[model samples]
Target: MSEYDDDFAEQGQAVYEALLARTGEAAPQPRLEPTRRVLDLLGDPQRAFPIIHLTGTNGKTSTSRLIESILRAYGLRTGLFTSPHLVSFNERIVLDGEPISNEALARNWDDIRPYVEMVDAELAEAGNEPLTFFEVLTVLAYASFADAPIDVGVIEVGMGGEWDSTNVADAQIAVFTPIDLDHVARLGSTIAEIARTKAGIIKPAATVVTAAQHPDALAEIRKAAERDEAVVIAQDVDFELTADHVAVGGQVISVRGRAGEYTDLYLPLYGDHQGQNAAVAIAVVETFLGDGSQPLGNDPLVEGLSEVTSPGRLQLVGIEPTVLVDAAHNPHGARSLAAALDKYFDFAETVFVLGVLGDKDAEGILSVLAPIAARIHITASSSSRSIPVDELAERAAAITVPGLVHAFDSAEDAVFAAREWANEGTSRLVVVTGSVVLAGEILDLAEAEEWKKA
Candidate 1:
């Protein structure tokens, strides 16, 4: 566990692990009342600071982190909470640009355990299930943020917005990345419905920043913003990636924000989509800091975005084999990842290491990657819901060219095989993707081995 699990605070990692074992998003909490009750028990800590709330199918975490980094650069003490942590549970609650310490995490949980147990007992008496894993984590994050007394909280919803556990707190600025047809079975079948569900965080008179979205998604978001009387700033209309070019380690892009045009900004990230993400983040911060009237000066904005890093999104993990790890689970995300791979790297042969959850559109994801991948190594992630490697390999073969699919029972073996294939002097690149779980597992392996990129 790399001292993550070892230095388990006074309570040890066992209790936290037990908490993690609870029902996850697979079992939905239909209402936000349970989370509200828990927060009420904890003295409504979400009210302790202002929040910049964000939600979407993909890029929510990235956008949220960017916003946090920018706000921190502006001298705001920050509390950031993003979901489905790549490697550590501690990643979900970051303060001042660092994940909450293990001691603090355990102590915060201990401080709230009695209150949570009280609520659990009350719910049991009422014949209803207790607060869930995410619900508890949300509570813990809110409490921890309050304890930190941060100047701002950048919160990303755990799931759909309206009823998400994190929605108990009203967002002063509601930001959305691209809304797509992910989690359709849970959110809704149609893009409009999903957008409506995500629009739940837009409070009255809030400033809303949204990425360029599908016509239907845009319509839904517009309707929500109008209903709330929010001042809306959308991509392509209110802001844009005016120009971008690939630099040595990242990209440089200029965005015309809601308030003013900022030029010659350096973003140390990949993809035009990330530049687009930078635009949305800039607009959100403009709305918050500039009141949509005047842009913040260039120095802070430049440094903030330049220093921003989104782990597991088009990240280079190792070299010689040239391993890349990205958590692009859905078709939309996969397409973006594929395009970024094409743009940022030159590989004679690219082998994709893929794993997918059973709930995702595995076929769609594979189809998107098929155009770019020379071969695919299918593997299962740590998720219990992951599609079997053999099944994924079979599906990938159907979508990809014949005889280019291989299956590994675990992500580790899959990575080993991909690296071996790359090492055969084929100018090869290995990309580990298809699910965040797989990315997390592979990244942990890379860190353990101290693999350096070529």
Candidate 2:
């Protein structure tokens, strides 16, 4: 699609390596100054297109993808940026509902390299660390969208909203997936605090779409909306997932949108939370394209939702023992993953391959998963932050039956063991969960071995 040759995997790999070398997203900079400066020098590319920004504790990626897909179905040129890729860095930045080509990625990075360095120089000159990994990527995403000259953009924040690099631009519309206690060390120790912090993305007069929240969390968002005079279309009020039942390939749902009701929409993703996510996504599109008084035509709505996929979220990546992977690194996410499994599958038992990060609530995750897991296979993922399997297993064993907890040094070994255990019977399933890095690693391993072809 460009002047460059098609063999650009090498270029993509180089870009990924360079990004990994930067101050990583794990070490988030709690300010947007560096990102602002970078964008300022790059002619503020974020201003080149309208945006629908999303932030929350979970479901943001799925919701963003839904909105982007719906827009593309309507024949709109769209750009989407989400975080914590499952397999490749290129997955994070999408154009026209597809991952940006490696050639385009390399070309965009080169075009903005000088300005990124300029911002890095300014920060270093002030005795500060250079831009953290996500900051630079945020700039790259915005710049790429400007070059693509997209009609709209759907951007998901990498973490807490107030100081996240992606907050540098004011979105025309802001969406929040459910907010829960997460990133307590960085955002805050309470739901209200985290809600307020994430609510920072709601710009003045921007229409806000949100899920039902804890009372205190709702108050914080409402307060922010009043301050900004933004309109809040909330779940169970402005919109709702009226019904969802298990169906082939995934599930079918009926959503009452802001202005209209959409029913029998077959979403390829599982779980009730995803149903609610689809509802919010539909509202966002309704607000974007038309009033709530009329719903989207059946063709685009059905086709988009039917084709939608939330990779690494309850995704069945292997067969024979039914290996599934989900990027449910937090307690809330773990709960959703567990519920989806129970609601969608009739497996008599399940073996879990879990590896949690250091900062996450391991006990909280185990508390939810251990109750349903037939056995626990603990292992270490590629992240430096992954908890040791021995330590993780000790914690997991306390919740699961004695002699049911096992440990492996690597994710591949853990998957192997889990699959072997699952093969004991057809009613058994193996699920890999707990961290984004672990999910990505498992997918990578599965592909290398020709495990299931996704």
Candidate 1 deviant stretches above 4 angstroms: 1-12
Highest lDDT scorer: 2
Could you give candidate 1's per-residue lDDT for residues 351-373 as a string of tens digits? 89989999999999988887777
Instruction: Quote model 2's TM-score.
Output: 0.97
lDDT of 2 by residue, 271-352 (tens): 8889989999999999888845677888998888887888899988898878889999899999899888889988999999
Q: How do the predictions measure up, each by TM-score?
A: 0.97, 0.97
Backbone clashes, each candidate = 0, 1
Q: How well does model 2 score by local distance difference test?
A: 0.89
**Model 2 alpha-carbon drift over 4 Å, by segment:** 1-6, 291-293
